[model samples]
Target: MSSTCVSPALPDSKTATTDPLPDIAASAPTHASTLDWVGMEDISLPLYLAGQPVLARASAGVSLDAAGARGIHMSRLYGALRELESRELDAARLSGVLEAFLASHEGLSSVAEVRLAGALPLERPALVSEAAGWKRYPFRIAARSEAGAVALELEIEVGYSSTCPCSAALARQAIQEQFDRDFSQSAVDAATVREWLGRAEGIVATPHSQRSEATVTVGLDPLVPTLPLPTLIDRVERALGTALQTAVKRVDEKAFALANGRNLMFCEDAVRRLDDALNADYAPQGYRVHVRHRESLHAHDAVARVERRAPDNR
Candidate 1:
């Protein structure tokens, strides 16, 4: 009687179940309400832009139109983003990704969107030297698929040097006053003035210049085949006329200084330059330009913004 007790056998994990695992998202919500957007953000991924690989942070989402469903399948949205790594990014590829997003969440979503943010590396040559270096321009690509149509947008940030117009005028006035004090009593001679101009005392006051940035966003026309990031960058840099240099010898530095002097611009001037450039050639559906000058003379930054819409778009 004392030896009669025995333990029962446990079920093997391998044979525990042949049935599917529970999916909570397939069930109804406790309180059903549709969400405007539902999905993932800050998903790290590798993206190819113009055949160059870049590390990107992606946000993928879809409108949650299914009021009864607990949630859309977030993994499906992430899976669709894999397309970004496979090929050079363009409007068509971006639209394809959005299409995949909607396909994966069909019947539960009508609108899908994807955003990619990364730095694009471009080789930049020195202004007056044979040397070259890589410059990373931060950019963002946003695309949405709604009502069976796709809309694409591109954004880029370009850095440049900006010399304040008012500051330049003020500095020139100060230098003129100083020159009058120095040469008022003496008869001015060309050779003597040349010697004086070479000295630091001759150019006593200098215009305030600062590292400035222009952020441009444009709605891409569907007919545009590729992502025109490099072209847009070139256009913006050319318009601004004093793009930040990567590698510089003394000659290049001097050339850069000369360029800045010749291209003195306030934030307003920078915005208008960008506006004219974008409107003239790269006619997007619409565009917005925002310029910021990080002031060396003041603690606060100077900023300006301009926006335009195509007549047809309006």
Candidate 2:
């Protein structure tokens, strides 16, 4: 029997939609492979560091331990960063954030890491004047949690003046030769020497000095209650003995010049000074020191580096 058959009327497409949204990352990957690190970087955020509010760039990541899983929950890692904004950054706080990352990932991750970078501003008083100005110290903090342990590291940059020892010696010799030539035929007297010293001809040459920078990275002890950023910076600057100044008056400039003259050093001297200071005073778990002297006498920069790790860590 030939009969026309009509299917029951179907629901409209708009009203019939009932499927859930797609989550591609929740599905198994086409190629199963464990990734070491996956997440976000250079994320701008506001956080408290060294007890001061700072705008920092953050990086959050976790290891993709599950081979079959397409990816870790990146949003969870990003969401965990909110803790940094609510509290002052420290080893304990960072460790907590990492723990949150692992908890959120559950079986998908075994390791988590967070990094923050920003400039710390401190108001510095002039060497011999009432003037004070802000000095910005660039710093980075990196923390990682794995196997129920947390590791923290801090890196900072300090600027100073470095006068070349060899240049100072050569300049002294030049001045001595000039003095000998001037006084060989004349009678020696305090007034005569003072007057000669006041003249430009007396000091024939000046030692070459240049602005230098020290970049120090140290592994923080887990027991440390707070990040020792200001203390570490003070130590580095004191070791160099000629920190760069802000809001300089004539007296401050003269004082700085005197400091540079007293602390004549090459890149090697600068690095060794920092190494000795850190070893004797701070005694961190591990540390790396790098000094760069931007040379005024030559086009090339002089640099020195030193690295040390505690015996147990090594």
Top model number, TM-score: 1
Model 1, residue 305: what's the lDDT?
98
Clashing pairs in 1: none
lDDT of 2 by residue, 273-308 (tens): 999999964454889999999999999999999999
lDDT (0-100) at residue 236 of candidate 2? Answer: 95
TM-score of each: 0.93, 0.92
Q: Per-residue lDDT for 74-113 in model 1, tens only? A: 9999888998786788888788889899998888999999
lDDT scores in order: 0.91, 0.91
lDDT of 2 at 195: 90
Residue 145 of model 1, lDDT score: 85
| Model 2 C-alpha lDDT versus the unseen true structure | 0.91
